[model samples]
Target chain A: MVSYVETTALRSPAMWFTANRLTTGLLLVILLILPFVAPRYWIYFAGLLGINIIATHGLNIMMGYTGLLSLGHAAFIGVGAYTAALAQIHLGLPFWIAIPLAGVMAAVIGVGFGLPSLRIRGLYLVIATLAAQFILNFVFVHWQSVTNGDVGLTVQPATIFGVSLNNETRIYYLILFAVVFMTWFVVNVIRSRVGRALIAVRERDLTAQVLGVEIVKYKLIAFALGSFYAGVAGGLLAYFNRFVNPEQFGLLLSVFFLSAVIVGGMGSTLGAILGAVFMTLLPELLREGALQVGDTFGFDIALILVPLRETVFGLLMVSFLILEPRGLAQLWKRAKQKFERR
Target chain B: MNFFIEYSIVGIASGGIYALIALGIIVIFKSSKTFNFAMGEMMMLSAYFFYAATVTYSLGLVAGFCVALAGSIAIALLIERVAIRPMLGRPFIAVVMVTFGIGSIIRGVVGMVWGPNDLQIPAILSRSPVMLGDIFIPGKTARAFAIAVVIVVGLIAYLRYSRAGVALRAAAADAITAYSMGIDVRRIIAFTWIIAAITGCISGVLMANVNTLTPHLGMVALNVLAVVILGGMNSIGGVLIAGFIIGWLEAVTGLMLGTEYREITPYILALMVLLVRPTGLFGTKEIERI
Candidate 1:
């Protein structure tokens, strides 16, 4: 009897590039033309989306890839924000230098918080991160001399050869480049030896340790790298918003980023991007719909709008967890497979 | 010296409320092995129900309390059936996120029903000062503290001796064994949620009396997180002691450094406890084979 075995192209680089490059090139072209084609409001929205994509990528590295859940992620972003603000205001450093400095500062703080992870895992680690969130937020509010005591600090725009990248359009381009770089960097990292080790630690730390993976080292690296991304995102946020306040980095925002990571797809880079876009756009769409409904029904939109948005946001998160735990990425893969089969 | 004594009494009284809130969290954890992050929201929602009953419907204090208790129980059961039951065997983070999502929904609904402003619920306790020997305690605080103590002690006794309570404990300890012994584990879980809602309702009313009712009332649950951690997740009696310690510490810190510092003391203490003893003061140490 003769048996036939189907040959898999999983190990072929040609197949991978041919499949990915077209979509990648198309996305890049769209992002590049978004400023001109999209309205001013959307350009501003795109900038904010870019910033969130960066922060979500950082969180995805920690929670999605490395299996370390951090509820204090916003605190790390805040750290980067304040660091960049201080660096620019006090040190008079340019945006180029200050942003990287912001990331480094956040990475250091991330390592400090990550130390507790060595001693604890799961729920305890989450609590430890929560402590970091509250404590750092406390510092932001009370440290009047540095943080301006809840009034927050105003940030200057990025400049190249003394031309201010101040407006939404210009900042959109800056954010666009940063997002592309960070996304590429994250994709490469996920394919590297360090990324594999991090994934190994995530799958089963004990087994990974038994197999000679330095669980401690990989865990800390994940925290540092994740926070570094958050910090850079924060720095960009400061310049983009032209302001940084304690409220912007609150616990709710941390939860927002976590939800984005979960909704995107935990371990995939494409998932991070999709999740950020969906979460950011969901609220705006809800608000617009609420306003239209209120106008038509002759009821007050002001009171119900915020609460309605929150309700929908939460409902989506719950339904996503229940109905699609693998998130949009899984759905995307399924669709792709169907198309390919056809 | 007089001020110190007064603050201590106030702090301990507030701690009683914290202990009550922590008790709800511990009960849910014990029965289902799922930490209900929405406990604070549950407490806040119950308080809002009381506000709606007494203020909106003019039901008076006694009727309002009953309405609030029933409302919280219904909400808790609804959440258990809709959100939690579907997520029974999911990962720890997923369950936690689901609860967080449920919390967000509750917060939004409360805000929509009752605007964002703080509304005063009809005061259940008196306002006159109580002379406790040399130091005078606020009447409302003293009365609320007494009520909290009675409830805590009563719950302790109920759990210690009651047959249903024993069955609940058995289910918590070993669900498979409890199931084989003819105990309905699912019913016990539902019962635990009811107990949690009851505790949350009482404490929510007490808390609203102490502080005004607002959507942000749920933020107090963050403080309870510290108490839950310090006492240990699985330890019932330990939470009481931990609650008192946290309350006292918050009062002292607030006195010394101001209100800003008071907000963070529990988290700092929780972090310290996590660093020193991750299992908490009374948590059972699990020996994992894998």
Candidate 2:
């Protein structure tokens, strides 16, 4: 059984620090060393992993904490990227200002889409959320004047506090810090009053509603906060890549994000991080291995299997679902738990 | 007059195909409370099956139809056993997500087999547009419309009157009670998927002829989700009507506002429908007891 903390607030700081120390240490080491030790290609790949984490964790808030399935996470990210790109290009706003603003804009629109959750539940709610993705994607692709009419908008590299950071290393640190901060924010929220209410609503909305939870407000709040995370992620992605295209933020990306959450554990924040990393890099690593093997044997196997990316990815998801539904987060948790028990 | 009549005729013709796709979704939703997220992918797969049977091996229409239909039935049953049946007693979300996973898997399979290229479907009907007054509708689209109408009306009638169809209705309404009443709910579930596959195959072939057959064109069938929402999940007639409404709306809107607006219109309409008729046009209100 899942053992949530019994007390709403932890009384012992000692236990808290002791319990989380290993996790913190591991995260710190990964954060410090991976950027340096990883190859340039991997560094770029890892940065993309961070973006996936942002979106996956945001989806975790919606689908996990609030129990609202959103098929439109990528669409919201599209909103974020489009808004940030437009502001950066047309308004000449600094990257620092535009990204957060884009996040805010996406959050507002996320609430607009989230309004349906008040009446619809389960499968109906899912379709309703899907409508948001379709509507937004169409608007993004079609609204030519605002969205550059399918030829995507370009933005300049980011500068923080008058220090222009152009290289991937600096961008890596920026992305790393953003993800860290976002992770910290989500963890803090989980330990907060609002997060508890959100969790309660997800567990059973009627009970929560009967207990004076205000279902509509919470549903909308869940959507806005979740979207805020996605927008921030999307904004970061746009600035990092220096361009935004509609194709990059389509329904498939939405599916990939969901795959991450599912392959991670749904409700856990660490699950989001682990899922994003695995989902993003697994294919690249597989392809790399295939190419290396093909090169050694002097065959054309890699190109033949190159298009099987989604098939392999999908098969992995099914295997995970059938064999280990709890995903990578559970494995990490179990190992840590066993170590602590010893 | 020319533009108006032309758009309407073309509109209805395309809308007819959409209606068939919607019917496929409706049949599946009738049995499983869960939406088959892979329905469009199933359509694409069936289209490929038919194409391979006909064009790849150069088999004529009759042999291709029989083989494709049988293949689709097997595939649907296989999916039921592997992807769906195992998750029978699990949470609803688990089932929905699994269907999506299965969909991705199917898409990948189709991509691998079909080589990610557009397959040219042999013209089943005439290429020239049929002229009526100032309205000139494409010959194939009109033929597709005629075929779709026959299938819809025929199936709807069969479902309404047949004994087996009554059993399906009974099982769908209340599975446990139907089981106690000696109804084979599981068998009905299997039948639902088979019927859904047939619907998919026919629609797929029609759509391939309507537009070019591409693996990615299945994305359009994702719009069936909107139709299901508007019509209500369990309502077959509602889906057919909603499909026409959506089809005509898209055609008229495409005429008035442009093509891009046409795609977005369904979602916008879906949002409004969710706000107003949350249970949808025919869906009974779902009661949640905490």
Candidate 3:
């Protein structure tokens, strides 16, 4: 019957730290043994889910926390992916250096786009970010010398200390490490003064400004930081896939990420994690479910499931918006409250 | 010079279609203040409906056109009633997300019904070229251009003169006040959606005839988005002009630069226009009170 706050804030720091350490250690052990326990295919999905989680976290910061809606978020991801790929291929930078460089590049672009939020907001900003997506996509497609255009660039395996992280298992471990570190950082950020400023800005910009919060500074920081996460996730994705293509980073992907933030519960870190996992597995789950139904009914439902899945996905967004505007995070909170009452 | 004129005409033809698409988007925005991201999907769906009527059902062109237009109208009404009506007091972004979802649903439905591959909806108009004193125009383009102009003019006149149009405009201006004045704001909103759907159908049919029909045809909405941004989101007549200007810009860019420039030019132009005048050339500037 413990309240949500009593369950967390009431706990002693030493006890909390011990619990955190135990959880972290257990998570690390589980991740290490996951490849041995689960199949290779699930491992790939897990890596992808991890990448989505990272990107969604950043998106949550911008859209969820700061109330800046970006329709071209995937462009930053592209910037990160391309930067890492190009850095590794042309400059021959190591994975460690290239990944951070990707984040920096995407952060730069994110800040550039964020500058307009100072002048415009609401729907105008959405269009502005959409413009960023299209422009960046155009560049990715046409800048043949750098991006290699439509043919796409095949990423070489990343290495560290003469050990190539070539296999999916190694990439999975790397993603796991990245996800844990990023999640920790994001959680810390949310609990910080800056995080409070971000929430204040999202709730009311005028009020936040009146309270001496530099709206522009915080907005730009949110964008840059969010995009940094996206860029890093993009780098991880590029390495894991061993390929980078302009086609992969489209407006649809941006919409998917935005949807994930919404579905998970905007502004909550846990919601981002949950949403990414749910959305990433959705199509696969739908396909399997459709196959089962097809087998049961003696009909080939698989042929139509792609469109059906899309329709259902759209329905989910609409229903969620109307029925659960606060998203799964809010739902989880409600469930926890019920449990506490019980 | 002749080549320039010809491409310009081609551009105008395509621009007219873009205007039609933008008209639908603007109409929806004017009434509800909701940007229907699904406008492109509506266009795509209506085009598929037209194809189904004419090709799949083997209906004649006249009957097929009616069925197609009617189907689009029905879909628009259904969407407004189901998804949009429930979203009245929601945040702007959430509503935008709903439209995005609607778009996905439409795309999925189209994919399921028609399959993912491109289907050629046979050109309803004659395929012969028209001679206009040293300029040659394709038959379908000429027909589409004419249809677009007629519809634009017709809609303008209707809005300026019709009782329903005046009520709709009033509702758009102040929904609460209009409701108090005994104007059925809800009906007006629904009518506006119908107009949007009609425009979607016309543009869809024209575009399908001009190009091969595919699930991705809705992506062209992005191009028309530049047109709407250029024309101003609320300015109906301005959208037409902006559409033509952008169409010409695309053509000129394609000629001077390369084929790739055509695809990206609209977005670049949209950005430039937005940075210079965020309200767009003819759009009403939204004033904020502190």
Candidate 4:
């Protein structure tokens, strides 16, 4: 199969790009150019996309590659965002320092949540994760001194050395850099023995156990690693927005993040990137339709559009599930295959 | 004693609403083994239909409410046909997300049609507060609660002894075996959804009395989750018990800790319950592996 794989994909540069590192490298290069060519609003949006990409990738580690359905994974992002925001404000840590601290804090918190997976499995574990979303969001909202209730804590610009990341363009680079490193690191992890064991467990934990995989260690590791990535994404989001609010992280967004993975194609890192890009950008594109419809009706329609947007978004999600359940990444693969056939 | 009676009464009233929602949720979950995460939205949408029936069509409130039931039942079957049917035998995530998607669409359609403002429902109960001694009960909230309790009890009785109800229970217990036993399992599942819709419709009307209706009514999502988790996801009886517990707790928390804390309480409890018992108080424990 490996020899056949080389013969099929190696002959064309386009095929090589689609099937290998070149496409990934090109995508990174394009992401770098995004800030310069796009409007400031879009730059901020793209930075948000990167942050979501990070979270989706983290979720993929558990849901896709490792075969765990963590419905409450956004809570880890909450842990990272709120904790990093707190550390920056109270402990007076630098943004860079606080960001890493967020990841570590999230990983530690995730372990507390992940311990249940050692005994429970499947949808029950998903429900258990749902508890994390509610609890974490509650802490962020009720812990008044730190989170300031729903008002959220105001954040200062991220500083590295003496330079401030004062603009969306600058923050975009920081998010971009973080996403690249994490994606590369995670992809490498999936190629390693740990990755194989995680996949083995996802396939069948009992079978993996018989094959000498430490199910407890691997499950915890998946949770910890996934949560760490979510934390980093949250920290970046907090810093980029220059504010951290409880409302931004909720079960709705958690569902949104999970949907991104599902619609992008589960079990693939590239799929996470495609899903993040599409889901993040989808609202903006959808808003355009609302605007056009409003123009027809002769009044500003943004408020009315809010509800319609959810429906449209939902319709697209259902359509994807019904028509192309494999998501955009799978669609991309199919398109590439067709091109090569010609 | 007055305080206990007041808080307890308020709790049961609200719990009655949640218990109905939970019952709707449980009936569907028992059959399909999936949480109807869309329950809040389903109720919210039906409430809009009820509004359309009562006000737009000039169907008097009783006739309108009955019409709303028919509309909701129709919507449920439509949803099953359009959104859910294609995903049959797909992974659990697809089904869950589709419901979430359906929820989003419902909110949008309702908002688009109804506008963003909360609809001021005409008073079904008399404007006066009814007094028993020193305790004053608002007529609307109390009546809604009573109606909800009566409906829930009646439904439970019907399900326990009725042939159709028995078929639903049998199908829920084991789909394949029931199918071989000559039960039309798909039809039973569809029927459960219709029943779910009817319950959700009643919940919406009750909720409308408590708070005005908006597309954002879907935000009542946490309450349903709390009931299911607390009651045990698959148990109707458990749901009834948990519903009042949560409702009373929320009211007491609002009275004692203030509304913000009250808002946070149910979510915190859900988290605690998940940590302590994921199957809920009555849910069946699942087993896969480490």
Better of 2 and 3 by DockQ: 3
lDDT by residue (B85-128, candidate 3, tens digit) is 98887667778888988999899889888888889996777889
- TM-score comparison, 2 vs 3, better candidate: 3
TM-score of each candidate structure, all chains considered together: 0.95, 0.92, 0.93, 0.91
True A-B contacts kept by model 3? 0.63
The segments of candidate 4 whose C-alpha lies over 4 angstroms from its true place after superposition are A1-19, A30-42, A71-74, B127-134, B277-279, B282-290
Between candidates 3 and 4, the one scoring higher on lDDT is 3
Per-residue alpha-carbon lDDT of candidate 1 for residues A172-226, written as tens digits (9 for 90 to 100): 9999999988987887787778888877777768888899998888988998999
Q: Candidate 3 regions off by >4 Å? A: A1-29, A295-305, B287-290
- For residues A90-146, what per-residue lDDT tens digits would candidate 2 score against the true structure? 888987788899899999998877765545566756776688888888878777888
Write the residue-wise lDDT of candidate 4 on A228-301 in tens digits. Answer: 98899889878988888888888778878877887787777777888988888877877887788778989878
Query: Each predicted complex: what DockQ?
Result: 0.45, 0.43, 0.45, 0.46
Worst 10 residues of 4 chain B by lDDT: B281-290
Q: Tens digits of per-residue lDDT for model 2 on B1-290?
A: 67876887777667677777787777776776656877888888888888999999988987887788888888889988887887676557767787788788888878767777778977777778777865678888889988987898788788889987898889878888999999888888888898888888898888888888887868878766677777777777776677777777788898899776887778888888877776668777663422
Specify the CAPRI tier of model 2. Answer: acceptable
- lDDT of candidate 1? 0.86
Better candidate number, 1 or 4, judged by lDDT: 1
